[model samples]
Target: MTSPFDPTPLPPPECPAHASGGAPEPEVSEIGPGGLRRLYGPAHEKDPMGLYEKLRAEHGPVAPVLLNGDVPAWLVLGHSENLHMTRTPSLYSRDSRRWRMLQDGSLDMTNPLAPIFAYQPVCVFADGAEHERQRGAVTDSIARIDHRGVRRFINRFSNRLVNDFCESGQADLVSQFAEHLPMMVMCQIIGMPEEYDEELVQAAREMLKGSEKAIAANEHVMGALYRLVARRRAEPEEDFATWLVEHPAQFTDDEAAHHLRLVLIAAYETTANLIANVLRMVLTDPRFRAQLSGGHMTLPEAVEQTLWDEPPFTTILGRWAAGDSELGGQKIKAGDALIVGIAPANVDPVVRPEPSASMQGNRAHLAFSGGPHECPGQDIGRAIADTGVDALLMRLPDIQLSVEEDELRWRSTLMSRHLIELPVSFAPRPPQEITGPVIPERAGAAARDWQISSPRRPDPAASGTVPQPGPVPAAPRTAPPAATVPAQRRGSAPVRAWRTLVTWWRGY
Candidate 1:
């Protein structure tokens, strides 16, 4: 078997600038163990976030870790700093050379898990207006998309899988339940035919498994897709392939293939890990499993907690500064690579509920990227997970972990974080066909509550004559300091102010 190593360089993560110049270690805190060592096989493969916390308690909260001498990166542990860094557009940037390297095709895909670079460049790699258009194409309905559509799709898919597994009394949740779910759904969403499903899924596995052979297979699929985009241009259909064919002026076939492949992997890879990670979360939290079984928590609620507690896409790769700049209290030079341990930031008590309670069931975090670059396909993911979990649980409420949770294995890949397999068994259920729309799971506006809200005033007891409670007033917003405001011309502010007043007056 190949050695377990990230395909990219593994520089000991940089500690904060405060710890720069061979300074003594800083502080770290301890949360419960995540069983990382036993799963990954090596101590170094253990989660840096966990180690960082240990280091922080031993040192100071603002810890510094030196890797490669000059690499100065710090752990932003507090909620305030994590939020400050994540939302900072001016100081911090999200760019990564890793994607560029992937497409460069220098690596040998001969290793089953080796990654072959792009079939072409995915559009997220592009910045500015071009990215907007590329992203906008699928985002058509975009934010307005009925997340319900996603739920329905997952419900259908999950039922099919559960019906197969629930009866077997045993199934490898990773391969049978989790991994296959995303790949098949990805194929459908990307408009690829079943003809390529098995091979594409197999290829996807290698990339995540980080096997050279799997990597090569993925490259083959990507290459075929590049060619297919051109061929499809001559013959259009109702899928993404046809969409690219029709929008010849907006993107070339090669570009479309490249972009689509990115979208597919983005959809598939994150999810493969998400399913595994969520399962791990459920297994670890007896209360959480009880919540699911007892219906105290709906699928949506459970997903929210898992997303915050242990999102699979722990770190997102981005380039520092597009070049480099001072960010998160560190002076980052241009051309530096950054691995934003985004998931860890999500779990910090500040951003999330105290990790302990949230571990029971709390706020959802941004496994998806935040702000402008946020995953446009989040609705699809939400829909898939909610539907899948709901259907599976409903079908087999008694399902239990076949292997001890600690004994389960985990592996990371070029694109995602995940488990090796999840074996589960339950009393069989009769196969049932899933048809029609799946109900939507409610996810709050952007996955977190930035401010507190008053309880919904309950409707007066239904006297049969009582009308429904009147619409409550919207919550007050946090106002910015006035001094920072630009001076407005004498009449302009009054005029605009009057217009706003009039609009509110009319609504009332």
Candidate 2:
């Protein structure tokens, strides 16, 4: 089932560029079903930045569209032409094999947009010096991490998931705290085994909702990451799947389980849709809840204004071209594909013309995307979304929202916009005194050795409240002890044959 669109031909003697002769076949159309209901309707899932400002005022800075309705491609939408096509990888090339409609097979390799533009072997589907040796073993194992031990392992999995719904004062917070605290701190930084955290967050959330059981949920998360790289090569710990099976880019154990399934599916799909779109802009925007409840916004300025006005990956995948150029003014050819429009280049009125009057001293945002395959663990997905939005604004400091920010809903998909649930409400407090030891959730290997020694979690570099520049240390206290869970697991033999292969692969 390899077709996440594989093409591969632009290497060796660098040959394939042949389409010039009479330079024509470009402007596509077929987008029917009433133009795919005006580009994925429900008003483009509740105003996709007003449909990227009406497709950048009628297709200006590179637009073209279609996908699923016909398949076309090219998107970009300015911001210095998506930073010169993602910092010029020699005229664009994050290898979607080297597309030309999946190299002339004319697309549709079981298209449901084949689990995000197909071809996966990780290091974001390599290119040039094999994308710097699988992105230098993921930026040198995320630069030998420590961001205050990732803000105390995301404040002990955001206070053990807000003490499992903080005594029912109401919650949903996107499936109990922004989709299971970044996939349980990416299965405790890939050492996995907390009895397979809800089967790897339900097989990476139905293989990122491109479902139809997305290729058997991407082979049940690549057979639980090739059995956690064969139990960290027969038991070697200190996580990140034993630092990518003891990396130095010697890979191969299925290339360190495809770069640990590309850093655990890009840390559970773009850090849980960027901490559920900065908690839906701090509970429905009223100017970021009066500048995040008055201390003038900081949780890294509401995650850099939610990565510059709403951006949990607004498309940045396919980028093929590499030959007959022109871009922004159109003509692209050689292989074609493109994309990048990251929410229309972060509101690009010729490069952010007063996008919300320059979001509090802006921090240029392609949302951790740009250049030689950007996002080397975007500062550990912004320290697990600024320590799970500073552990729900320091333990639900009077939370809010139980509905009506125009009654939410969004989640159409063709590259995430997320929020199929947030629901809120607060004023509960009290439950925060657990010092540590609580195991017993079918105590398998004593609950994966108490999530590998109670959040003594480390790996993910840091620095003073996010202006960023590394060298860490000093930040520890991760909460975990209040228990009560039972979805079964008990004893071992590789977690009872990996919980009978995730209950016989979810009985289907």
Candidate 3:
């Protein structure tokens, strides 16, 4: 039932101009894209991005490898393949079967009597209109980083966790702090009852660990979410849960519940890893620390750059091609997996030269993925993580890792770059309200959501123009399409009103 030159429609191409620009297509080892089982061990052990970089260095961006020893997977390191994957949904299916493995019966849950379930996704996993609907509500409900609010939450909870383990001073940052932050914030965003925060987090964490025991334990977590979905269905509130309930055009009860799980799961790892990784990276480089600690620089810019250059999504996402195709002139057969190399794609030398450039530019990093299939909740994801960083740095500015940086252990996974644990000495930042310490850095709607940068290239996947690793780009392409700003934006309305009132008072 398969033909090498079958009738499946090929994807629409971007400007093929850049395909001929810089370097010749990299070389690959496997005789054909189908012979990827040979490249499994190193690729699996080193994370997809690391393995992809090696292949790109030797083979090319379109290096084909095998997934889990049998299935063929394409390593789409080149801009064209990356963009093409996003654009052509017909050739790829995001419906991942790996998620179902979480439901294996060997694991047991706190709610042993609970119903068995399936792996669900937010709009990011959806195609066309359904995906769009989920995307719309998701884009709306992302909680912003309010310095005051996040500060309060971090202080109230983190201090307790630290205090509980202070004398010992060796609590796993993954469980104690990094994991707890996102769990708590997600609860807050969803308007879950405060009493259930710990209970809910425990369940969610169970699902997160992805083990047989953890899977079974996740029943409680999924059950609580199920109950909450029903409650919101009856009486919707203003929080994300309520919005999800009201957005009938976007998702159903089942869809919303799955999305809720996806959001929490997605939000949890990235936030934890970003914060913990920044600590590791900074601690590793004392000069960077001196620059940050000595007031020469704030960690935000450094944090943004580090995220761009060395993203936590070392092995974050994977895709399965729906049809046979050619990317960068390389063969890609149907039933092949295509994992996005966010870290490599970000630091491709072609994407951003300095890698440390501030966000004061266009959305440049593949760290968030691109095209319609891009991570819809990244803004919210960044906001939550940024809040944690802001909280940690602002509340515990002088915090130092308890162990030597060299002794720090890193975990090997297909998804992210993370330390096993980050034990630190917590110290609060000196309280001095500087003038405009945190500015939006936006000249327009899309003026770098994470940093302050301008748009330079419309199709960044292939566009040669890029910022020179600075805070802001000198020649960003142009403004993006006009999107209606949400009035419910956390601090946007208050900030505007407060400024206007002050100006009026001054005039009077």
Summarize candidate 1's per-residue lDDT along 1-508 as a digit string, tens digits: 1111123432233425224356655432222122111112223244555654554354332233322222223434444454555565444444334333233432322322223222224555545566566666645423322343334455566776777666678888788878778876666545454434567777866655554375487677778677667656664433455454444135766667766777777777777677767766665667675654443555567777777765767655443344344544445544444444565566554555565664435444657856566787876775566556545654665667888878887664322456788887777657875553222222232211111122222332433221222323342333211111111112223434433432232221
Instruction: Please report the TM-score between candidate 1 and the true structure.
Output: 0.67
Provide the clashing-pair count of each candidate structure.
Answer: 40, 9, 23
lDDT of 3 by residue, 226-322 (tens): 8878887775543567666654344677777877777777777777777676656665665455554444444455566667756767643466566
Model 3 is weakest, by summed lDDT over 10 consecutive residues, at 480-489
Candidate 3, number of clashes: 23
lDDT of 3 at 378: 65
The regions of model 1 sitting more than 4 angstroms off are 1-41, 55-120, 141-146, 244-249, 322-324, 359-364, 412-416, 433-508
Q: Tens-digit lDDT track for model 2 on 1-508? A: 1112233322222212222235653433323322422344355666666776777787678876655534566677788888888888877887788778776676645555666778877767677788887787777666655544445556666877888888888888888888888877776666664535766687788877766676787788888888878877776655567666666566888888877777887777888888988878776777766554444555666787788887787876678887878877777777778788787788887766877754776777787778888788777787788667765655665677888888888885556688889888876656675444322232134322222332322333432111222333232333333222111112222334433432232221
Q: What is the TM-score of each predicted model, taking all chains together?
A: 0.67, 0.33, 0.66
Candidate 1 CA-lDDT value: 0.51
How does candidate 2 fare on TM-score? 0.33
